[model samples]
Target: MLNFLKKNAALIWAKKHVQKAEEFKKNAEKNQDELLLSLVDTAKKTLFGRTYDFENIQSVKDFQGKVPVADYEDLKPYVEKVKRGQRDILWIETPEYFAKTSGTTSGSKYIPISKEGMPFQVKGAQSALFHYIAKKNNADFVGGKMIFLQGSPELEEVFGVKTGRLSGIVAHHIPNYLQKNRLPSWETNMIEDWETKVDKIVEETERENMTLISGIPPWLIMYFEKLIEKNGKKIKQIFPNLQLIVTGGVNYEPYRDKMEELLGGKVDIVQTFPASEGFFAFQDDYTKEGLLLLTNHGIFYEFIPLEQYGKPDAQRLTLKDVELNKDYALILTTNSGLWAYSIGDVVRFIDKNPHRILVSGRTKHFTSAFGEHVIAFEVEEAIKSTVEKFPAQITEFHLAPEVNPEEGLPYHEWFIEFEKEPENLDLFKNELDDQLRKRNTYYDDLISGNILQKLHITRLQKNAFQEYAKAQGKLGGQNKIPRLANDRKIADLLKVYKK
Candidate 1:
């Protein structure tokens, strides 16, 4: 009865977020304007502010002129000073925690999270849940057990502040209301080894009333696979109350087919865009295809067109300047003290009124070995479109360029693990290649001009991706395999598991 009341009260408060969101979304420009001024007012006393002359900054143009668009490398010097217990270097307040994450070129990076900023992360997640509740007008799942497959909650001190993965850090901030409904005991959550952790999770949740699950799609796949392997039945059969799957960090569309297969049908999925730096957006409307930008959050946004990305005088555009369907690199200036920070993710605006966007790909994660810049969005779409015609069940896939093959010309190597292979593998390959060619004209030219052969498909054994991730000490949690790379580092590792 207490649980029932908690659900009712939580739903009532969550609806308030929907109402608040409606207010700002109507005037995203005004929200961003006020948000920027608030951020600037708080950060104007820092060392960075003095250097950039933040006090003199009056308009968006003035702010952009004062602060250059920066990458992690550009901001590393300031970050280093903060690690040595320096305050007011970036923001007046010291960071309470540093979220550690793997970097693309750099080995690892530590992102600061301030006391003032941390609550917004929690609220953003809550707001996402609330938005879903508002959309569906259903909170039936809240009374049942919920699980969020994440990294260990254990943290280490970095200087004076705690340091851990983004997910782990967020774990400590889960609201009191959710503490009762959430599952997988704290001791079970503390297991460092993912295999052992999943085993314990399977045991703990096997017979429980699991109504909702949250995690990256890949890790959830592992958990679902383990449960099905043990229980000898599908997920829905085991937990009939399951209603919603909250997923984020990576795109969920790529794994939709297999995830549905495991669940024995379709289920509601709410996609969110949360990172160590900030919670940027969440899927607000079920009918829409993209995430709604969080303008009222403490972070201010800037969009740099991918085409104009690397130029010396690249234009840093505001929300007012962005157009629909054009690729742009996302930048953030947060209360945590990152100034014009490049988060490395590419996005495309699908709606402008309320500012809804699709995460296209990463800035550095692209296949351009032969000057054909094939992005994650294009490749994933190509595969998704081809799968419609081929009717194959793909478990996982990765793409890398075989720049120097033994005999033939260069080509893209697609390592695919299929649960159910298409009846005609040759036809599937032909159709996929055709689809990609239609999408990326440069790739089409490369193939047509004989600069490269048709992409090669190396059929991988079941559990191939899982095995590869296991070998790298990144089997579960927020870790994700890059969809495409310019080199063979991942491709060579995956070769051993080819069917």
Candidate 2:
């Protein structure tokens, strides 16, 4: 009777939310201008608002003209003030907490999370699952445990505000009724050590009926490895009822084959684009190629073309102005007080009707030092192709420019940790080089001109990335090995583990 009631309630919840999501899409399409104007008007009372003269801004053009696109460094002072318990600094009031994320080019970032902004994050997550359920026409998974392999929820107080990982904060706010179906209790989740937490999770969920799993791909892979090691069975064998897998943070293309191999069967995947700043997008339709942008959410977005990213007087465009297939660096002006914030991510719009996007790469995570611009998507595709052709699997990899004046010619240095090493390493390296050349015309041109030499592949010892991440205090949850770097910072660090 209890199980029946729970399942029925879950169905009702999903049904209600699915209708709201549809309504939201319709409303956004019809009233985008009105919504943005309302957002500006609502925020006009805040500190950032007052300083920017939001009260006088009558249109998107005026708002764009008044506010400059800002990176984290530009807003750090305001964030610091909020950290010290200052009120009415950026938002109407101080943030309820801050989410600390490892910055790519910069150091640690503290993103403000206001009370009003919290619901959007929660609703975004819930709507993602609800959309999946509505599309697949199956809510049976809700009756079983859904494990979210995430960070610890135990927050460290920054002045009066509680700050922690965004995932941790979201985990702490999971609806009370759904608590019965969630795995790894609060006590287990609060464990600081990732390895220890994984052990405890394996122990706790080993016998449970785990139907759904959600997390970043690498950490999910780690958990699966541990589970298989303990039980001597594949994931599907262990959890016969397992139905869906949702992943994001990094591109899922590279990890797809490996994950399927471990699961022992085809598992449905739903991708999401969740950041500490806000829950931006989610895979709404299984048939669709890109994630549907959460338009009606509390966040307002702008985009600058990739070519115009660092250039002064670059065009900052709103949703109405974006073109399909062009790469654009994402900018956000949110309810949480991020005014025209450049969040460093680049994306391409695939559809405009419902606003679907494909996350292409990061602003700082590309290589163009030698005029051979290589984005993360291109690199990832090349890696995927190389792995498919060879009998090798990459555990982790990083590519950096080798541009020493003393060296004869500039080249891309690939530092790779392989799970299954190819019998002929030379062939593997050549294949990777050929694949990348085929994909990127600029890189091919440079190689043809002899201005850039062929890629140099350096094989690192097993578990090198894990050791490096541990050393940097960034092992597990959300933190990832940056696949491409413009400089040799990551390459230099990985040099210590060269085989």
Candidate 3:
């Protein structure tokens, strides 16, 4: 009863505010620079001398380029201070919740998320929703049960804290009005609660009349595949109204074809960029090539050239100063208590009016085993192109790095699952390897130097990737087999099922 009330209330509020949100976007775009600067000033006042090293940053004579580049590590001192209950580190007005991010192998980065921080994320989320509404121009369709496959409950002191990283934070801010009947009750929490409630989560989602679903691509893909396997041809028939499918957290271009095949339709996937710090952008319109940066919300954006991150004299430019089509590393200052924070994402301006950006890839999620650095986006594109050339139906794929210890020759081994046997498998592999070399100059250079071998493609029968993921204990919802693994050790772990 409470959930129902929240859903209806949220819908009513949305009906009243959707137009204004659209107007806010247009106005923000028209007066981009002034609004951005004003927001930055507000952030400085709200966070400076409180949550971060504001005086040190403000003291820099050349604020643009003089301030040193910061990774997540740079903020550790401040976070540690906060964790230790030091009153001097921050002056948080109304402390609410902290959002955890998937940290680098070690632990997790718990970012303090406040109520002030939520409005911005809400804006981005709503903007994406408005875009979806505008696409079909069906404002009435917003009234339905939306199920977000996010994190589950975790032990927090005496009670189980219901959350998981970004998904958890998103869940946390699920406007007080939208919590009742409109929201699906099932939680696709991460590995934290998977051991006990995996079957239960599947049962709840399968039972609920879930109209809207949003999650990371790999997880959604795995879930739908599981549904097909479990229910046979009755899968799609069960969730006929499950229309809108929103995803981010990974690149979707390479997996789109496979996902469409599995889901049985071209599901609307609104790509978004949500980090531990804040929600950055969302695809505002269906046809747009890039996502609209939530310029008016929680974040103040800054960009430096990818080549200039480490340089002592690299200029950190604002939105007004960015060059379109050029790759730049994103540095953000957000209302969520993070200042001049480096989110480790690389983006390029795709549209100017609405300030849309294309998230190319992560700065460090790359392979440089052969001196030729192949970023995630490049490898994904290469794999997609290679898969398309084959006449056989490709089910799933993974690219693993192969580095020789003795001779130091490095190359990538491709593992693929296909529906049928290819006519000329060897020739196809050679052509794909040639395509990779031609597309990436670094790979070609490594090939010429005898440092990288020609690509080796191995085709597995259907469900190979799924079985591999299950073996890794990454089955059920929200778990996916990573398309690219950087090291041979991680690669071997991912491919332990190879006979």
Q: In model 1, where do residues sit more than 4 Å from their true spots?
A: none
Task: Estimate every model's Cα lDDT from 0 to 1.
Answer: 0.89, 0.87, 0.63
TM-score of 2: 0.95
Clashes of each: 0, 0, 6
User: What TM-score does candidate 3 get on C-alpha atoms?
Assistant: 0.82
What are the per-residue Cα lDDT tens digits for candidate 2 across 1-499? 7777776777787788888777767666446566667778877887778888989999888998898889999998888888888888888778987999887556889999889888888888788888888788777788789897668898899998989999999987898877989998889888988888889999999999999999888888889999999999999999998989988898888887778878997678899999999999999986568998998888888899998998988998878789998889999988788888998899999998778999989988999888877999888889999999988888778999999846689789999988888899999888999999998899999999999888989999987988999889887888887899999988999999999
Q: After superposition, which runs of candidate 2 have C-alpha atoms over 4 Å from their true positions?
A: 26-30, 104-107, 405-408
Per-residue C-alpha lDDT of model 3 across residues 1-499, encoded as one tens digit per residue: 6545544555555556656666656765345455434444454434335333343344222334333556668767766565554432333543345566556643676676656776676667776776676565553334455666667534242112122455655665576544663443534453354434435545566766656777776667556666676677443465766667778777777767767777775456678877657788888776667887877775667788876776777777777678888778888765655656778788889777767788876776666666666666666667667667876456666777777634555668877776555689887788777777776787888788777778777666556766676676665444445555566654665455453
Each prediction's TM-score versus the true structure:
0.97, 0.95, 0.82
Please give, for residues 1-499, the per-residue lDDT of candidate 1 as tens digits: 9767867876787788789778888999877877787788788888888888889888888898889989888888888899999988888867988999988676799899888888988888888889988888878888899997667889999788899988888889998878887888889999988999989999999999999999999888989999999989999999998999999988888898889999995578999999999999999975568999998778899999998887778998999899999999999999898989999999999998889999999998899999999999999999999998877989889999999899899999999999999999999999999999999999999999999999999999999999999999888888889999989999999999989
| Lowest lDDT block of 10, candidate 2 | 27-36
RMSD per candidate (Å) reads 1.4, 2.0, 4.5
Steric clash pairs (candidate 1):
none
**Roughly what TM-score does model 1 have, to 2 decimal places?**
0.97
Provide the lDDT at 337 for model 2: 86
